[model samples]
Target chain A: MQIETGELINITDKGNNLFHLIIKADKIADKALPGQFIQVYCSEGESYDPLLPRPFSLFRIEKEKGCLELVFRVVGRGTSWLSKRHTGSSLKLLGPLGRGFTDPREFSRVLIFAGGIGMPPLFSVAEVSKEVDFTLFYGARSQGELIFLERWQQMTDQIFLATDDGSAGQQGNIVELASSLLDSGSADFYYACGPRPMLKAVKRLMAKLKIPGELSLEERMACGVGACLGCVCRTTSGYARVCTEGPVFAAEEVVFNE
Target chain B: MNDPRLIVKVGQFSLKNPVLTASGTFGFAREYNRLFPVSALGGIAAKGLTVQPRAGNPPPRLVETPSGLINAIGLQNPGLTAFLQQELPFLRELGTAVIVNIAGFTIDEFAHLASVLDGETGITALEVNISCPNVKKGGMAFGIHPEAAARVTRTVREATSLPVWVKLSPNVTAITEIAQAVEEAGADAITLINTLPGMAIDIKNRRPVLGNISGGLSGPAVKPVALHHLWQVYKAVKIPIVGMGGISTPEDALEFIMAGATAVAVGTAMFHDPYTPLKIINGLSGYLDVEQVGRVEDLIGIAHKKDGLD
Candidate 1:
């Protein structure tokens, strides 16, 4: 993990308040991996209004061009400030921090679940392990929120989608869709990233099916490194820092709070 | 001339500079060492240690407020035995002064911690943390009251031969009363102020944001409160003061020194920028050169002095 100033090379409006940012940061891109994240300083120099840096998963790592991609939505002040930045500006990033997902190539059959902004890290997993067979179950609020659909379709034919309003593939939720599909199908391993409810439901499904998997977690972080112990998630062992021990953990190891 | 001297003395020991990373913020100096050489700083107070391992509070441990962060880490540490066996050796070799911050449930626990660390090499001093606001039993429970605060300070003072710096809490009625009480009890220096008790609510959930319900507030938000308390305590106590709370930049550190602090500690700002302490050290050097000051020691409590204005 190093602090690198990455120049904003490009910005794409993925629509529905979601943005795709590409930064030219050689060192950070060189070190980044799937499921790892970078802490972006929202404000310009010497400003502490939004005092803490916001953590973002490495949506895409283009090492050859020394570029890193971030996918974020304008949810609050920090992301709002991030959205207003123009191309050619610079962002201070501290990354590629935290333990990432298990190498996708290690598993013969892989299942991926992504919800809303949670798609980035899992998308990274699919991008890195192209040779591995993957079944993606993606859910969003509606059709507009289902970002990068063409990209996922290009990657695999086994893509399944769900939207809350039934404006997309399946109605209700992605967890139920994935659960029903898995009744006749089997995967060696699974990976999930999304809202806590989705993750919890996936965890339950994985437990019921007796399939081992990993879940990427999120929390409000202070020190992106483990120094502060601010972003910890309860685990079977005890509390583990999401900044270090995870942003990803074995599904079974996590004890989700009710 | 050569670079302006950044060195300053706190109690009996001399620090290489007037900048120290606040306890709980810097960890054991191991984490920040990955970003920069921690030895460049004046000193480091390791995270608060207890007699036994603490799991701390549950998740949602932190919440970002306006220009501040509220955290209820609850002093989760690797316990005393692990510190001696695993952490201290690494700290001893950091080539910087290591001030171990200890928290305890009772006065005896405080004494026990001090006694165990008494002859430990490479430790510059013992920062008795009676100011932590997260824990239910010992932390600020002893800190809010003068007699209790003085009792903890006196017990630790007797247990160890090292310099004792009592870290004070801002969530008190009269901070000076506790400061003076600790001074009278044999505290060599005072570290004020710990995070001010504060909370945030999740409006959607209609619940408190932090898992601990309420946590101590730190960062730029508490700067004024910390400075006010430090200014008051500086007048009440003769011992040196290690001023902290929302200290991030060289200007902030200079403000603390001018307000009567011998040294200043960078706390919540380190979360925003890990290189903050190093930046402050260089900034201090640059400030001294620009002002034509000889040493950082020359500026201590300068604001409190009655000059031509008086």
Candidate 2:
């Protein structure tokens, strides 16, 4: 995938303290795959204060509009600036980077798992594919953090929600929910993207059930390409770059530390 | 007319230009494809590879200082084998000379790395990193001492016929001695300076900003130091020098050339502007033509004294 510099055209607060930034970059949209991301340069406040741009998975690409979308939560100065930008704000970007999910060949059933911000990238994967026997397992801290549920639910064949507080769907983690489904012989291959712990949990469950899967690891990156040697993951073979070799790696190949 | 023919030979490799991306900054040169074609630049120095694969240190691995950045990535790499199998194919297809930068924990590790890379003909050059302070032991990064530096360079030089460039650390008191040592040991050229080791305190958190307490400081903060090192070593060694550290602008690239660098590698500048190398290359080409410069090599070491008056 090609890495391009993007200009922030408009930043819309998607309310609930979330933001939907419309960044205009044709190169990003043209080259971006499902799970690939863009490192947004929003550290404009202090010169060299926030050293690097924050990495965000691509949400959707609007080619005709000449813009790409990033759904981000304001957790720091970088996202805060991204959330407040007006139209015609130019933001530098390096992206369409990291290996995305490998497109499955004709499988009977596909299982999709996402927790928190992880849902955004999976949304694209689901959007690109056809009407297959697919089930999406989504988990969050509470009902409010179950982001992009309405639209994603409408897109997929089946939707299962699990929140930590039990304030939403099943009162359990997504891994437990997935284990039951796989036990019922409803899943063929699993695809997951989320925080490290959640991914680790799901990977363990997959291994226990002898189910095959692909995982998208979220690592803090420097170059967002293979150059920085900053975002690296240990695998059965050796070290793999999260930016180039993957953000998505086969479950069997990885050796999760924690 | 712009001289698109700024190609020059550095060591045995013939580069399209004298501008190359510094290791740990340019990311295999693919990151810039969205903005410009990477082939437009002279070359790409792959991120530091290691003997065994490294997961690197935990983030926040990077922190921005005044005009520089401190990164303690800990030489995270997927080892040489995986890189060759997975990433090297794509890198070779980019049609630019790929300089593989390898780090070792021991003398044998460096030799093993070179031996493993010997059969990989797609690689244009091998850059030996002996300057990373973030790793444990043999990250002996070769530049710390003249003896250690020469030993590592000589080992790699014996292992492969590929042109070897030893990337030097800037934290040392004297850099020329090490440069001379590597040159005498048969290094094709030298890349200087690696990031200087430094620390930053998070006033609010009242602790260090980097996960690794100390990180390498790069960017504009280290440009003057880079110039000094380049100036000192350029006179001490007859081999070519690729100057880096905190270069961000065309003027900065010119300054390195004036200080006797045959080429300039843009580092922390990549963090700020991903298209910096292209900009520097284009800017240099423009500056050279306008100044009636006949060749890029003429710019190297032009900052000489008037008949030893200085």
- Residue A187 C-alpha lDDT in model 1: 86
lDDT of each: 0.92, 0.80
TM-score for predicted model 1 compared with the true structure: 0.98
State the lDDT of candidate 2 residue by residue for A1-258, as single tens digits. 445557777777766678877788997787788888888876663355455677888778676776788887887677776787788877777777778886654566788889887777877777766566778999988898887788886887488889989999999899888777677366778889888889999889877877788888776566676667666677887667777888889999888775
Q: What share of the true interface contacts does candidate 2 keep?
A: 0.45
Q: Give the TM-score of each candidate.
A: 0.98, 0.78
lDDT of 1 by residue, B103-220 (tens): 9999999999999999788899999999899999999999999999999999999999999999999988899999999999999999999998889999999999998999999999
lDDT tens readout by residue for model 1, A1-258: 999999999998888899999999999999899999999998878799899999999888898999999899888889989998999998999999999999999988899999998999988889987999989999999999989888999999999999999999998899999888895248889999999999999999988988899999999999999999999999999999999999999999999878
Docking class of 2: acceptable
| Maximum-DockQ candidate | 1
The TM-score, computed over Cα atoms with residue i paired to residue i, of candidate 2 is 0.78
